[model samples]
Target: MTMPAFVKPRQVIGHHLVLRDATPADAEFIVALRTDESKSRFISKTSSDVSQQVAWLEKYAQDNSQVYFIMEDREHNPVGTVRLYDQQGDSFCWGSWVIREGSPSGYAVESALMVYQFALSLGFTRAHFDVRKGNESVWKFHERFGAVRTEETELDYFYSLSREAIDKSLAKYAKFLPGGIQVIAA
Candidate 1:
């Protein structure tokens, strides 16, 4: 089976931000982003050690099923992180998403559309993700895309989106991501 290219985007650019694959050079920043108390509550992993962070990056480097991204504003300042991983046939997962406090309101929304576009561009038919049950903000964000909650873990709510739903959501949000979606830029 063919893996999706969003796993390692050279650079998925949109109106408000750029999403690129994570590298060892980003270890410190990734650590800080993932550990911030505000962001850590909803995340499953909270280890703050940089060496361990780099080790995780190294392992991800070899995993075709995962793609970790560093999100930056057009001015090139790191603002967030997200990942698309856990491919099972034509479906995959997207999450590990976090944005800094006080970012422009639309960055998260547009960045998510970029992720869905990248996944659909790879011909994948479904996208799955989990949100901690109490993370109302993130949960609502996913809901806007017409995601349906398919399961509930003790600590999280699992949501899935059909390709058709994603495509439709993209249209609803296209104005926010001007230039459409060039998900894979060679």
Candidate 2:
């Protein structure tokens, strides 16, 4: 079956950033972004090889369960990467999210709000992800969106945010979403 547009939107526009689908051509950037020294400690280990990244994207292209995006600034400069994955019954998982270390203050908020809006628009009732236990900074970051801790593994803390909860938190960040988040039709 064909996945919905929110699962693989060609482009998602926010006030300060635009998230575009990651193409095979973006393999190099993805590799560099994920392997960058500054951001490496926050995420799980990823391939440093371009060819390996390309192979992964090729495989991902066929897997409707995962969607990758390259987040860029209003001027179209790469900011970071994010993904919505593991589409199952009524919930999906979201992560692979990162914003460039020194990107302007707004990029981080825009990227996250866009993803939560995208998931809700696509009919997902809930979203889940795990942040490293040591990453207290980001744990607090996700809290801004009403994410509640659901699990605590030795290495990570899992969070679950319901669409209802996310919606309630939208107003707090509404000023950051330019067009006020275009919710796709069901």
Clashes of 2: 0
Q: How badly does each model clash, as a count of residue pairs? A: 0, 0
> Best candidate per TM-score, number?
1
> Which ranges in model 1 have alpha carbons more than 4 Å from their true place?
1-7, 183-186
At residue 36, what lDDT does model 2 achieve?
88
- Give, for candidate 2, the lowest lDDT window spanning 10 residues: 177-186
Model 2: how far is 42 from its true place, Å?
A: 2.3
For residues 71-184, could you state the per-residue lDDT of candidate 2 as single tens digits? 988798888999998766667788898787788887778788888888777777787888998988889988878899998989999998887778877778788885865532
Per-residue alpha-carbon lDDT of model 1 for 41-148, expressed as tens digits? 878876778999889888888877787889999899999998888887788898889898889999888888888877777768898888899999888988888999
Q: What is the lDDT of residue 43 in candidate 2?
A: 90
In order, candidate lDDTs are 0.84, 0.81
lDDT of model 2, residue 44: 85
RMSD in order of candidates? 1.9, 3.0
Candidate 2: pairs in clash: none
CA shift of 186, model 2, Å: 17
Measured against the true structure, the TM-scores of the candidates, in listed sequence, are 0.92, 0.90
